[model samples]
Target: MATFEEQLKALESVVERLERGDLPLEEALKLFEQGVGLSDGCKKELEAAEGRVQVLLQNRNGTRRVEDLDLEA
Candidate 1:
């Protein structure tokens, strides 16, 4: 199984390719499908992480705050 990080990296690459706007229609469609799948995978992973953290807060008295992990800044 691809890890969350790997899927995220693939998604970034897919976006970059689309932004370049050089791909043919068929290629673009394939990449678009891949991008969608990767996006969905990333969302699922994030939701799972959030649920785990909520459980942590309830059972372990952990703080729920999250730090920014964005790379765009």
Candidate 2:
């Protein structure tokens, strides 16, 4: 399985190719499908990481809590 970074990089490359409009219809469709899968995978990984962070930030009383992450930075 590809790492999250690898998947994201592939998705970016797919987008760049699609944007260039040089690929045939069939090839473009295939790349689009792959891009969709890559996007979903990236999202799932990010959510899992966020969950881990939330768990790590839990109070010592054993209660889980989540604080908003400043992803803009």
Candidate 3:
């Protein structure tokens, strides 16, 4: 399995290629599909990492405290 960074890089490459507007319809479609899969994988990896960070933050000071992160603030 590719690492998150690798998947992200691949997705970027796919976007760049698609933006060139030179690929045949079939080829572009294939790349689009691959890009979608890569994007989903990257998202899952990021969510998992965020969960880990939250766990660490909550466990600081040898006590387990649960809190929702307010990213919108």
Candidate 4:
């Protein structure tokens, strides 16, 4: 499996290619689909990292307290 950074880089490359506007319709569509998948994967990874950060913050006082992170504030 590609690391998150690799996937992100690949997504960027895909966007650059698409923006060039020179690919055949079929190839462009394929790249677009791949980009969407990469974007979704990156989002999920980021959310997981955020959750881990929240947990660490809550444990700063040396007590292991797990709580749901409220991001709506």
List where candidate 2 sits over 4 angstroms from the true fold: 71-73
Task: State the local distance difference test value for candidate 1.
Answer: 0.89
- Model 4 reaches what TM-score against the true structure? 0.78
Q: How many residue pairs clash in each candidate?
A: 0, 0, 0, 0
- Candidate 2: 10-residue stretch with minimal lDDT: 62-71
Clashing pairs in 4: none
For model 1, the stretches where C-alpha displacement exceeds 4 angstroms are: 59-73
* Cα shift from native, residue 63, model 3 (Å): 9.1
Q: Write candidate 1's Cα lDDT for 1-73 as tens digits.
A: 7999999999999999999999999999999999999999999999998777666555345557555445697
Worst 10 residues of 3 by lDDT: 58-67
In candidate 3, what are the lDDT values of residues 1-73, reduced to their tens digit? 9999999999999999999999999999999999999999999998998878777877547776657778899
Model 2, residue 70: C-alpha shift (Å): 3.9
Error of 1 at 29 (Å): 0.7
Superposed on all Cα atoms, model 4 deviates from the true structure by an RMSD in Å of 5.5
Q: Write the per-residue lDDT of candidate 4 for residues 1-73, one digit (tens) a residue.
A: 8889999999999999999999999999999999999999999999899778766877657766666668998
All models: lDDT? Answer: 0.89, 0.96, 0.92, 0.91
The candidate that wins on TM-score is 2
Better of 1 and 4 by lDDT: 4
Best-to-worst order by lDDT is 2, 3, 4, 1
